[model samples]
Target: MNRKEFLAKLGMGAAFALTATCLGSCSSDNAGETGDVDFTLDLDAAANAELLQEGGFVISNKVVVAKNSDGEFVAATVVCSHEDLEQIVFQNNIWRCTAHLAEFNQQGEGLNANGSNGLAIYQTELSGNMLRVFS
Candidate 1:
């Protein structure tokens, strides 16, 4: 699909369309130093309950780990495409940047309004009681 159509399908309005120049810098060259995920989260850890609870999330190591409204686990790089801030907040199944109000859905689709870019979503896997997030 064309860029415009792809953006539209993600709920990104015309204003948020990504130009060729901007698209080139949307994400980092390296998502992980190694092929493996950096950490293994304990699902039973009390400290992680809030993040694992529905509609809750936590930002650390430039990544956001959240439990969306559906109680499904989701993860994404927290760096804002607009200003490269790690200040991302998750609410109502959407991730928003505090610096520029850039918004993206759980599936990592950038929304309209601030002309910001989408975040890099990661794969979340549940293995026994541990949750692993990877690029």
Candidate 2:
């Protein structure tokens, strides 16, 4: 059938319902929800061995913890402020959302239009081989 005939047979309500379902599935239930986050990681552990290297990062408890180029630990919520997607990654000393490419600085300041809402930042403390990340 032609496009119009096909659409007419499908019905607008059905089309809208399908569209709504697709949109809903693309959203996150944890949107805008950065829960109370206070955790610790052992740098000596193999799971967190990346933190020992400069410019390495890990995602834990929905938080992106990274060791910047300065050999310092920095952290931010993995949830992107733009689309509320858990796709934040640490790269080149910047927090970027892989979903929409939103960028934020180490201090959680938004650096682009998609990231203007800013990200949630946490404090980090390193004592011995333990790294503490807290909101």
Candidate 3:
């Protein structure tokens, strides 16, 4: 190839390589390292029957603790399944996603157009007044 043509091709190749590298580094998945996220909820303070009846349900970016009608305490992640956003809010005994307005029952069942892919329900164990949640 001619000198001018060879130099132009080399420059174009370098530009493509640089663009790919920059794009790879800009991914949201690389924002942080995923680690074990474990949290404890005070069942007495969080999952009382009176509160559930009064507030309907409790949804927060933080872990939610609630007792079913069977008197069993339940805890689960409040993170939204759609976009990993903390959009779940507790009102009227149901969990609702603020982002897409998707609603879920206390059991983490989706109740809207975004059904099927529900909230992430973590395993919970109660020890006295505290409920521990783990993946």
What TM-score does each of the candidates earn? 0.68, 0.76, 0.50
Backbone steric clashes in candidate 2, count: 0
lDDT of 3 by residue, 25-99 (tens): 322221111234467655467444343344534543355545555555554465666455665666555666665
Residue runs of model 2 more than 4 Å from their true location after superposition:
1-33
Top model number, lDDT: 2
lDDT of 1 by residue, 80-109 (tens): 666576667787789787755678877767
Kindly indicate the candidate among 2 and 3 with the higher TM-score. Answer: 2
Measured with C-alpha atoms, the lDDT of residue 100 in candidate 3 is: 53
Order of candidate numbers by lDDT, starting with the best: 2, 1, 3
| Tens digit of per-residue lDDT, candidate 2, span 14-58 | 757655654644443332448788999999889998898899999
Q: Rank candidates by TM-score, best first.
A: 2, 1, 3
Q: lDDT for every model?
A: 0.69, 0.83, 0.56
**For candidate 1, what is the lDDT?**
0.69
C-alpha displacement of 124 in model 2, angstroms? 0.5
Question: In candidate 1, which residue pairs clash?
Answer: none
Deviation of model 2 at 134, angstroms: 0.4
* Clashes by residue pair, model 2: none
The TM-score that candidate 2 achieves is 0.76
Model 2, CA-based lDDT: 0.83
Pitting candidate 1 against candidate 3, the one with the higher lDDT is 1
Runs in model 3 lying further than 4 Å from the true structure: 1-37, 43-62, 68-71
C-alpha-based local distance difference test score of model 3: 0.56
